[model samples]
Target: MTFKLTPKQEAQVSLISSDATHIMAYGGSRSGKTFGFVRAVLIRALAHKSRHAMLRYRFNHIKASIVLDTLPKVMELCFPGVADNCKLDKTDWYYSLPNGSEIWFGGLDDKERTEKILGQEYATLYLNECSQIPYASRNMAITRLAQKTPLRLKAYYDCNPPGMAHWTYRLFVERRDPDRRTPVANPGNFAAIMMNPKDNEANLDPKYLEELQSMSESMRRRFWLGQFADVTDTALWTLELLDQQRIVDGELPDMVRIVVAVDPSGVSGEEDKRSDEVGIVVCGLGNDGRGYILEDLSGRMSPADWGKAVVSAFDRHEADCVVAEENFGGAMVQEIIRSASADSSRKVGGQVPYRPVRASRGKIARAEPIAALFDQQKVSLVGLFPEMEDQLCAMTTAGYVGSRSPDRADAMIWGLASLFPAMTKQNAGPNGARSPVVNLGYKSMKRKRA
Candidate 1:
């Protein structure tokens, strides 16, 4: 009943004590955000005699970071001597308390599996690194936390900035409050709050402050400052590149042509045993003169299998042409695809007319321009492709493995170039096209750089 609170955590708890249905405590690393929330859960469950509580993290990282490292500390601090009786069940990832109020831990990595857990009713929900889960999943989870027992249900979401450009962040923090006096009716009906690391000065150790100061510029910004920033000042594409053209669903517009881009893999089968993937994207130009990223068809396949995928998109979107990079498989890529399409009575323009391209720059160089289009809102995703977006958002200069794939990014470039051939035509050479120098901007959100 008398656990000590960090200054930063005290501020967070004080804010949560309000009547808001949803509360968000987000900020820097080592700010005691998770620890504070754990204590808060104990207090709430004990006070109200709640039946169930939940704590979640991104799926892939739950075991090492949240469950193994932090969860026990939280249990010891709150329940004291009961830590021995409280079991750490690896299979279920939960700790049962004597009060009948149990705390469950989980990750949102696997969408299907996570969905099954969301079906359960709970009194309180604590989410760590809420940004890792897709906005759609987050939205789904928040709505599923309903109970008829009137057990004073509440949800706690803690994250670091810059949250994804998805709906969850938009609905909770980014959008302006609509008339403070009038409660904005929303699906979750949850209250949200945000705070900087500096706001929790009491919880931070003096040594931690000194270490933070001694760290490099990038480290300082990522941890202590809690800024959504890029590592480098000179980036290939700045945030200004996105074009603000709204996409009206179901509205077909007349105008420029549509092109398909393909990044094919050289493997085949029902299983994901392919060494690489074939990423096919369909991008179109609107009559209004803005770029539109239509669809993403990405996965493992042989050259012939990818050809069928390409033909499918080509027919579906009525693409004017298809462009592919010949660096990996060369002209054989064209032959194999044409051969496959031939089986289906469709020809890839007299032996698969593949536009040869080479990659002389890094992946970041190729992706910066596309990211600009997204930031400018010039490029809008027609449908949801969680795997592709996960790759794009989580991609770091170092590398990204736990998230999604860059197949979508590759397909986009191909699609854009194919649709608007003139865009990259000027730089075209026999060897390859010379991409412009791109600025590699650091992240706009605080992330634990491993």
Candidate 2:
């Protein structure tokens, strides 16, 4: 096969071949940035006995998205039989060419693997899906781009552009140093170009473009048009605040109590595909008296599907109980839980414990207190929750301002409220004594005539 580059990819190749120290290829999803960038790295590796590293925010993500998917495609289509000459190291996650060159893949979320990759100097470093990576980790990896090879050392980055506040936007678009918030010493060293689905139409489905056009304005701007979404001035949560409290993978403290909260969006299977997403979030109360968010399983699913997801999260996390929003349809929601528990494959002794919660206040009224916990830095996210964080950042004092519904944020708030009863003291009875849910079967003698 002849190696060909689309105009967008050709632009990237020209920029990368230049003397620029950093190259950013960012834009909409399904663009050719990743393929072009990976092919360039392989070209360099095959040219000399140089070392290259391909990294993403998470090891599993990079493995699935690039190492397993894009890398193989690029090798087979463009490089052809050259892939057969390379030996893949599954243990350390890299490819060893017939020559002395090496290509390593890693996820910054994995501390152990990151240490191993950082030990080696690389002629080239490619940060894939860099929007999800923290600025601090990028700096840490940049220190290792010091291999003494014949090729000029370079670092490549690509992303489905995040908000304007992201480091990529500051460094590549604003030409400002991310940390210092000032002009970079050499502005010419940082270069970036946008590549949207429109530019890669030949490689995409016609229906895909229509799908992108059907999205909300904000969603279309970021994913389809490849524009940097803005952080609203009235948002209660900021990206920096979430990053400050983010706990790296494999570092969660001992959990004292865990609960799964669900907010069903009235979608029951294929019957209603246009309903809002079902918000499912698992939160744990650590022994240190702080909160740790375990997972976000929110999506648009039928009752059976969301119910299964809820029960699955319950069993996987070993949560005390599953709390769901009953305001949608009290009896129907309860029945769904009962049916889901009956059908659960985990084989619970009888049924997973179910609790129904009613929403007496509006979303902002409920989120204000939860946002305060974040403001106080008492809560930490176990990993990145991009969609959940988006909803949170769109919530403000006035209303839910985002294009999509804030169901994920609502579920998170409910989980936190359940874990910290003090956060919702208003729901209690008079004199601050919260009413407890009592199991009626244990009663033999009453309170002894107190």
Candidate 3:
């Protein structure tokens, strides 16, 4: 394959080759940032005795995303069979080029692997998705960029902008120490460039751009427009809070109860392109006393399709029940779930445990209490859910500014609220008497590994 750089990618390459010791590429998704960065690093790795490291917050992510996918794709497309001549060190997770250059990969979360990688010196250290990586890890990794190689020592960082509060924004964009909040000594040494999806429009599908265009305002700015987020104070949830609460998929606790909450859009799956997306979120109340949001399956789907999705998610998680809003479809949602749930091959329909919830109040009104639990640090998203999280951040004390229906966030709230019944809005009794609310509290935090 003939290699060529898009205008945005060429600009990124020029930035990497600059005098700045700490270079960062950030902005929206699929702007060819990673491809350009990886290609530049691989070029530097061509120098004999050159040492480099590719790293991320988690080992699995680096391996699956960069090591197994991006690296090889770049190698074949740009470097042309350089991969064939290289030997991958499966044990340490790196590639040993025939020219005596070595590129190592490690996850900061894996202490043993991190220690091993950090023990060695490197000419280049590329921190993929630096937003998820802690400042401590970045600092420690920077110390290893001290190898006496022909190439200049440099540290490369990239991420889809998380929020202004993230270390990347503080250090690169604000030119301040991430932890101390003090001014950085040499501001020029830290350089960052924003590369949104639009900058690489020629390489992206029109439909993909349309998808980005349709994202909630916050997400559109962060991922589509490629800008740092400025979450409002009145907003019940901020990106910073969500970042702190994110746990890897392996950290979920044994679930006492799991529910799949469906917020029906009242549109068929095959309906017009402008129809609302059905919100399908799976949430669990952990035995360890934290609320876990397991998945976001929200999308535009027909009644039968969404019904199958609900049953599929229920079967996969062995959820205790299906909690869906009855405001829109009434009995239609129930019948679809029941019908799709039928195993026609066996001539029997599975009796799915269903609970229909009524929305008696506005979205933000019902979501306020659920959002409070997030502030209390009692909610753990079992991995990243960008769309759902974006919707959450769009919600304020007054109203929601995230999406058309804000269905995903609503579904998540319903699933979690069902787990903590006391937090959910209760139907008023005679004389306006409501059910007594239960205190939602936890003693301490504990880690559970899958």
Candidate 4:
């Protein structure tokens, strides 16, 4: 079998063959970093009799991603027709090669499993998705990189560049001692290389590039361009702030009012060229008077589809009402909600209360109070919502700089405003003056209760 690797993969293979004690292959998604390093590990394991370990943040992730996807493909590509020669121990998650070399797979999240892995010594250590592994666990694993063998003792790390604040950036890219906060001029045995998706274009789907191009600038830089971007000062919200105020499920008191807020996308049909997402967020005012974000059901859907989603969230949470922004579609938005609710398949009987909110101010102006609420510790997230959190963090006082519209953040703001009317009134103007609340003009349409 004839197999040809891309130039970047060839370079990575060469690096792996060298005597670098700590080697890193950082790059964009599908840039062949993992496959290259896996191949290198195989070559080293096959060439010498040594024990090696492959690790990720979680054991299940390794099993699901590498063990099920990449490793088999690597074996087929590198060692053609040699499958029968390898012995895989499913119980222990290790494989024994014909050359008396063994490779073990483990995760850092499991304390017992991590301890067992740390107890053993290894000639080679491959930390897959190293960005997800904490610095403490990484430091602990590095201490075990000692196994008596003819093969050179080395470690390979590969991950799409995370935030610049990550330890990987400080240690390898900046060549700084994380603990001492000092630079190492000669970083003797450490080396790092950046690879972009374009470098290995042949292996990726043609549509993948387009998808990456459509991503937000911050996400594009980190995933498609392979750069460590500082997300702290540039963005209004940080991961630390969100994590600090995050609440576990079922930790909130009984809610006084639960509202599902919607930021409707203008695209009315499925065939519309625009793919703008309809932001639907479920939030509640707890008995303690604190706001708890329950869920984010935002998605790119037509008017009918998003209306159904709003109805579903209303029923699921037994919400008081569905508050929708009427900036895009005035009365039509309410009609869409009614039409979707009237569907027999939905099992929704009678009228669903719909409140239309018109945005009289800019997004940033309306979002300021919400951001203030978060800062004041009046708002808490019930669970992790990566996409929603990303949008939330990307929003700033000036405006949202994310690639897509911050519909999710907008919906969250609306929900909070409904619960805390003071947020819409106090400190709303530029000079700390109260801003007049936009009259919603409460008009109720009579319908039988479901």
- Please report the candidate that would top lDDT against the real structure: 2
lDDT of 4 by residue, 1-450 (tens): 488999998888778777678999997878999898888888888888989999987687787678778888999987886667998888988988998899999988789999988899999899988766777878899899999988889999988777677778888988997667699666867888888899989878979987776676656776789887677664656554554456542245667677899988886655665767788999987766688899999887877788888888887877778898988878888888888777423243465877788898888888887878876767888865667877887887667988888888889988888777667853255776655433232222111233
> How does each model score on TM-score?
0.49, 0.72, 0.74, 0.69
The residue-by-residue lDDT of candidate 3 on 344-389, one tens digit each, is: 3212236677989999988888999998998787888887677888
Off by over 4 Å in 1: 1-3, 48-57, 163-169, 174-183, 186-222, 227-365, 368-450
Each model's Cα RMSD = 16.3, 7.9, 7.0, 9.0
Model 2, global lDDT: 0.84
Comparing 1 and 4 on TM-score, the stronger one:
4
lDDT of each: 0.58, 0.84, 0.82, 0.79
Backbone clashes in model 4, listed as residue pairs: none
The whole-model C-alpha lDDT of candidate 4 against the native structure comes to 0.79
Clashes of each: 23, 1, 3, 0
Q: How far out, in Å, is residue 117 in model 4? A: 1.3
Q: Candidate 2 on 1-450: residue-level lDDT in tens?
A: 466778999998999999898999988878899999999999999999989999987687778778878999999988899988888899988899989799999989779889999999999999988767889999999999999988999999998777788899999999999899999999989989899999989888999999887765666777799998788667788765665566653445567677899987877665566778899999987766788888999988888888888888877876777888899989888777777787655435667878788999999989988999988878988876768987888998889988868999999999988877677764586788875432222211111111
Residue runs of model 3 more than 4 Å from their true location after superposition: 233-237, 240-258, 262-279, 284-320, 324-350, 355-387, 395-407, 416-450
Candidate 3 local distance difference test against the native? 0.82
User: Candidates sorted by lDDT, descending order?
Assistant: 2, 3, 4, 1
